[model samples]
Target: MNQTDTPDKSDLSSISQAAGKDNACGTNSGTHLSRRGFLKRSATASAGILIVPSFVVSGLGHTAPSDRLNIAGVGVGGRGFSVLQAMENDANIVALCDVDWRYAQRCFDHFPNARKYWDWRVMYEEMLNDIDAVVVATSDHTHAAVAAYAMSLGKHVYVEKPLTHTVYESRLLTRLAAEYRVATQMGNQGASDEGVNLMVEWIRNGEIGEVTHVEAFTDRPIWPQGINTPKDAMPVPDTLNWDLFIGPARMRPYHEIYTPWNFRGFWDFGTGALGDMACHIVHPAFKALELGYPDRVQGSSTLLLQDSAPMAQKVALFYPQRDSSFGRLPAVRLDWYDGGLQPLRPEGWPDGRNMNHRGGGVLFHGTKDTLVCGCYGADPWLLSGRVPSVPQHERRVATNHQLDWIRACKESPDSRTETKSAFHEAGPFNETVVMGVLAVRLQALNKELHWDGENMRFTNISADEELTIIMEEGFSITDGRPSFSRPRTEPINAQAFAEGLIRTQYRSGWSLPPMPA
Candidate 1:
């Protein structure tokens, strides 16, 4: 991963002033240092002055960890590797696990002392004493299993965005994290950027008037929909433990396409375009608007692939509860367009201003103005009128997401620079985006789902029943079901809504721990 470019010194200084600290950082107060003081001390500290110790010993601090934070990483490839690299400067990597040993082997070269495991469960049990935190960056299907297990052990966690494979898993994760009181952060690192926060502050201050609607779009295309394709099952490479790669995912014939990056488009392992992009694209707008559970969600999509395949393009609509803060505001409707799909622009915006980029982004339509921003959590550049200005505020931008998490792990939760990193704040955002994923999946099935957020089910009785039947049929209404089905032991946890379904199982001896009571 490329190093994050350093902002101008003047910009940093301005940010520090706005933050009211030498370090313009934000996190939960219990687990953070005074950013101002840290920056001040770092500036004068000599080469050998252990950075973390200087802050701790001086008590220029608050609550500090009794021991150094130990971190283990699962899925150390792609984004996972990036996160690991980011954390390397601040935390000790005690263990590394990946289904594809080859992928993780490269990472081990960097941390020669860390134990390596093909299965995360093995890492969890064997490295129990060596790890205080875990990073879960596996495929969407395995997110909940890894994270829930980690949190259950009272380990702090940093899971990738879109939280879980299904709404049920999302709820389970949130509950378990709360029960365990683990510090948690989703991998929507953009949430820590000053631009995203500025967008939130802008909306909170009504810069564009009360937001009534939002449009988010992504250019992601569906591919490698599943391993059921004609690709010949190849011999498992010696460097990779094929059985482990199928973790939590049902037993499947191994295909080369399923490995590396193509898994994101497959229903069995990933969330497709909606799940892959919505978390980053819609987060700022969702947070800025203080949007909560949607009253209803509906979706439409083009069936570009076979019934067994993931959808190529889709659109989802979320109708949120009315808010008095915006004055009898209309239910905020968020439109998500993915897989080269695009929403019709609001009536008055310039036609040509539409973004041509294939990546995803969000557009907020308020009473008096429209705001368009880049997809993938890029900073917002006012697309229309000047946003109402407020008093200058501090801009907290973390140089590294992993480092931020390490810093949080070392401090009490109350001292953290921002609370959003915690599951409470990140959960809702994940829920909202993942809901969009569920809606898209339903649309793919040509099912009309009328969601009742409070009830967390379709109000249409028949549809609700069909949903249960579908689940029984070995297909998850949120995430697609595996090619096979398991016996239904208990009624599906209707209350446990999940956008992605965890249908696959890990290789033998690599099962995730049961959800803690």
Candidate 2:
């Protein structure tokens, strides 16, 4: 694994070009921008311009303030309802779509003026002109299909955390967002927290010396395992659109236990503890240290009831890239613990052991000092003996993550802080944490896997083969393959095994846009 910390310049450039291309503006004419016109438009813009569009007094496809950024909510239940409530404060909620009619009915009651649809595709097709943004808070399985389609239609998106169900899906969504040139934000609201910003500055300024190791822990074993639960095929609920719910997954009989909250424990629907909490817990360390993918991930834990579910106590080791700008050290090691697991105390920190609480958070150990953080590592308090000269830092409470997103959407991109909520920053953080889920999957298969960060694959060929087989029986290729790797026999969807990218099957009239030429 070539764990080097340099962004692929070519890839960045392509992203820039994609973002610069003009979007299909009007509903009537999809043929407005010719190839030459697109090239001309792209040539006149700088990379910054790609993110911050110049105000055009008036032109074709130009969005009007009165258009009101028509918006839709894909899953308007629980957290989805919260997302809808947040969006209501900013943009018009023109449509509400959900597989559960009950959820949709509740949302409809809240926004009586908005159109309601049990299917997202119907909502999009019928109200395409009315919608300019989409909020996708559906189950992991349905994320890719809805988000991909929304992006294809030139709509801005705010998808919930863990950005995608699988690695392939994450990269796919990122690519489509760039290609569509629409403003995007992931659901990792802590990315904009003041405390997280302070943590990054402290680490960058060497307040904790050269950070060689980090440990993040979470208590996410609340969901019961589905193992040994008799596969009693029950009739689909009257309010549930079962087929739409199963959008891309291989079909399975309906079970009440698998719906709503319980989906997190199932391999076919969710990525378990790491996927559920990694995005929140790992953000502070990843952003502060500027770490990329890990070189090798090894995990050890007690298997819970479900064979496919993540273990109760798990630890993932991340070996940082040698060329990373975050530190001058040759390499760094990061440990992630969850399900009540705790990190071993550092050599001299008196209160290190005291910081071992349940829930989720991160611990940083440096050559000279240590620091412990809370709220999924988004908030931190320095704890060490070597910091006599260091100044005391205050932590800020982030009352609302959604407000941060709304504020960014309403403000100029350049005016926003570097720590502003952004997919570029948030996406990588998600990738790092979700790796723990992948590690759990590998551990379940009883394979010791070595990762090649530059190649984004296992260094051991046999291990790689085993990973491919376990991911999708025979599917080997991944859409997110690093530029330097050899192509796999299968496509990206096959590589996204448990991410649930392929879990939900769309209804008759719904389909993802064909991959762009």
Candidate 3:
């Protein structure tokens, strides 16, 4: 909750390191860094990196194209560790932040120069000037909060796929990125693939006459789902910071079922299979075809659970043909099949050919040809082994995901320097994909939910009730903004919540000293 504007300029020498302690719940002295002494000089005393007042990069010392960025990371375990690893060639990891120490010990030991912390907020507060960028690899629900906080202070952010837990958070973060003009990238490596451009060229060249349908599939939810919520609470692990692990999520009792990875199955913690893999599986078609919002979306699934995703589910999305720079295209249907569900193989596809070449694939049915590719949009090819003369007109890159973002963070934006999956691109893609997931959530209501993506709400069903943003009281993104002190919209009373599904219960977690009544 110690959110505010970032210091105008950074002086790494002014920063002091905190003494080491094994683990603390973050209530008393051992909980965080020495905040008051983090920066020795007044914020106004230094000359900032930018001539312009805002939308500035944070690394004061590293200015050249070759200088390494002072990057900090939250959730530096699982996927987070790899993301940071990929950028190691260009980043000086100034700090490593994660809630689970046992899982994070590898990364901690790897980057001995980095100071470790249990909470991202404390890390950001104390190491404000030292970090030029933030890489967030937390759970789906916590993605937007951590990314938004870092971006608010003018740090470039690279968040893992799907962008945010809820549609609202995704939209808000998109706006924030544009407002801040900081380099932003969502973790969809396919956006950087040479194959994506190849596929786009094929579609644009009309080798595939006006793409009419898309069948995307993934065999996900390999984890537990469509099950009863665990009733028994377990003792919190000594190495895990339970409160910080919860982040902005509504507090729940410690349970093995929710941590060390399985959270993807839970509605509150992960995006199930759709959120987990669809960003990669569905992205090529989405980007090549320039799909924005869907006209409407609906779904069918095995018994839907309030606490977890269905064991198997399929979301069907309808999109009216929208004008694009390529050309006018016909209306299209994008069907997402997950939990091993798959669309009927298109009739024109050759007999004996596998519908899904890999565990996941995308099929674009066009009037002239059908294009297919694997999960990362790798090795795209037309049906019947037909290879059209696709002269490579689009720019090509070799494994440019993390490298592209790293470049964007330091260089000025131009044709070759822009991050391919910049928030604007990734936000809408995730928004459209998430709509299908949203449809699946209404299995009980069993009705097509028409979305108004521009308005960030549902038009027909008034699903605004479901769109409310809840957070632990002190954690609201609006925490430090005095202007929003009064409720602008009708305040929501939280019954409970999770990430990727609900507004986290935005109003809990505080042990503040008493104030004058």
Worst 10 residues of 1 by lDDT: 23-32
TM-score of 2: 0.73
Q: Model 1, 123-180: lDDT tens per residue?
A: 5544545577898898887888788766655578999976876665776777776665
> For residues 111-173, could you state the per-residue lDDT of candidate 3 as single tens digits?
878877766656766677778889999888788878775666678899998787777677767
Q: Name the top TM-score candidate.
A: 3
TM-score, each model?
0.74, 0.73, 0.82
Task: Tell me the tens digit of each residue's lDDT in model 2 across 1-517.
Answer: 0101111322211111123432222111221222234333333332324322211111112443333446788887757778778667656887777766555566767887776555565455556566767888888767777887676665667888767676656656766655655567777766667667678777777888888788878777678642433358988665665666766665678888777777777766777777777777777877777787777777666643332464565656666555556445545677777666777765665753555443677888877668777755544766654333434353343445655444334433344322244666665556566566667655544655566644445555341332332221122456965333222234223234332322234444334444343
lDDT of each: 0.61, 0.59, 0.71
User: In model 2, where is the ten-residue run with the lowest total lDDT?
Assistant: 1-10
lDDT ranking, high to low:
3, 1, 2
